[model samples]
Target: MTGGTSDARDRLIEGTRQLLWDRGYVGTSPTAIWKAAGVGQGSMYHHFDGKPDLVLAAEERAASEMQDQVRRILSGEGPAYDRIAAYLLKERDALRGCPIGRLAADPEIAGDATLREPVRETFVVLHECLVAAIEEGKAGGEFRDDLDAAGISYALSAVIQGGYTLARAEGSVVPFDRAVQGALELLRLATHEGR
Candidate 1:
């Protein structure tokens, strides 16, 4: 019974996360969440106050998953530039927009600071992690000494977000690949100039 309860709660959060990502906050309903989770209305409400409560929990889970993925990608044995490039080009099934970025764009989410806090914090953590890696690379002479680690971190992140947007907008992965390729080319140019 205890195990079952935990399973149900996990299902509810996972379901909410998927639904919220596929369809923004406004489109996802408590009914849809309950259905997707294979839980009854009573079960969902017992675990969460409502959609907002559940949404916040879901966002946190998503953020944690992304952080874990980043750590794994960044910690691997390789040249820093290679690791960074690997992270950028890592294979994913499809362009299912960044969950946190999607939430950030929702007006309802943006209006509520409490709701937006996790999304903002997630990006901050990601940026800091990337910047630290870049700084390490600079120290090792792998990256340009004059590189602005902070700006580059944000720029790399922005390119990713923009790639998703372009892919979704143009209904193809071409734009996404082009965006990443362009960024990679710039890095190559900088490295050559640095040497």
Candidate 2:
């Protein structure tokens, strides 16, 4: 009984995650979550107060996963340049776009202050971490001293989102790959020349 209950809850959470990814928050519903999880309405309501509650859970799941991935990539042993470059080159499915960025576009998500606050915080935290990493690289001479960590962090993020948008619009991964490659090459040049 205990295992069954846990499985059902996990299924609900995982289902919500995928559903939110596939569809924006405005498009996801408690009914959809129940159907996807193969659980009943009562079961979902038992786990969450409502859709907003469940959506928050899904967002947190997505945020935590992203944070874990970023930490792992940045933590790799080597020069900061290599680590940052490796992080840029990390493979992605290319088209679905970032989970966190997807959340940012959900109208329902933005309207809910409770939900919106954390979602905004997630990006802020991610940007801050990237900035810190870049700053560390600058100090270590792996990046240019003139590099603005804050500006570059946002630029990097914008490039990623723009790349994904371009790929989805064009229905090709070439644009996405080119964007990252171009960004990396520019970074390499800038850092090498002590930008």
Candidate 3:
């Protein structure tokens, strides 16, 4: 592809990412994407088969970015508990909600397998990362061996997603902060040295 064509495609993908995160699949129209990307309709069609095809590219990009961020935090130097705490405590735009997690509630996206696959896989990978961290902590005696890593991973994931929902619902970040704090406190209790 020519430099201009490549640039247009990248713009479209990025525009789709922003629109999808803010407006969802149904609400994000082709015209909106074109407008956001500053590309003409012909350019959009020339670069993509259709909105779904372009959206797949956008979702793939978003999922990859999210995975990279999580992997970096989880794999960083520290005790497993510390790494997990960092993952949970990391700053976020709580009111805006999780880019991928918000897609879970979008009827148009959730109903379509092609568009939903990346979102599903993103969460699956995140859960696996969390499970690994918990297992590592258990092995190192930072957490109890009797704890269910998979279950705790699921709980942590839920807390984060639910925190976003709660924050958005209330139009404030307090609920989200409270949810994260609660989760962190529970983790501290589970991994307490005396325990």
| Each model's Cα RMSD | 1.6, 1.7, 0.9
Candidate 2 residue lDDT tens string, 37-79: 9999899888788888888887888888888787787765777
Q: What is the C-alpha lDDT of each candidate?
A: 0.84, 0.82, 0.93
Best by lDDT: 3
Per-residue CA lDDT of candidate 3, range 1-195, in tens? 899999999999999999999999988999999999999999999999999999999999999999999999987788988899899989899999999998888999899998999999999989999999999899988999888999999999999999999999999999999999999888888884735
Worst 10 residues of 3 by lDDT: 186-195
Candidate 3's displacement at residue 120, Å, is 0.6
Cα deviation in Å at residue 164, candidate 2?
1.0
Tally clashes: model 1: 0
- Candidate 2 accuracy as lDDT: 0.82
TM-score of each: 0.94, 0.93, 0.98
Where does model 1 exceed 4 Å of error?
Answer: 192-195
In model 2, the worst 10-residue window by lDDT is 186-195
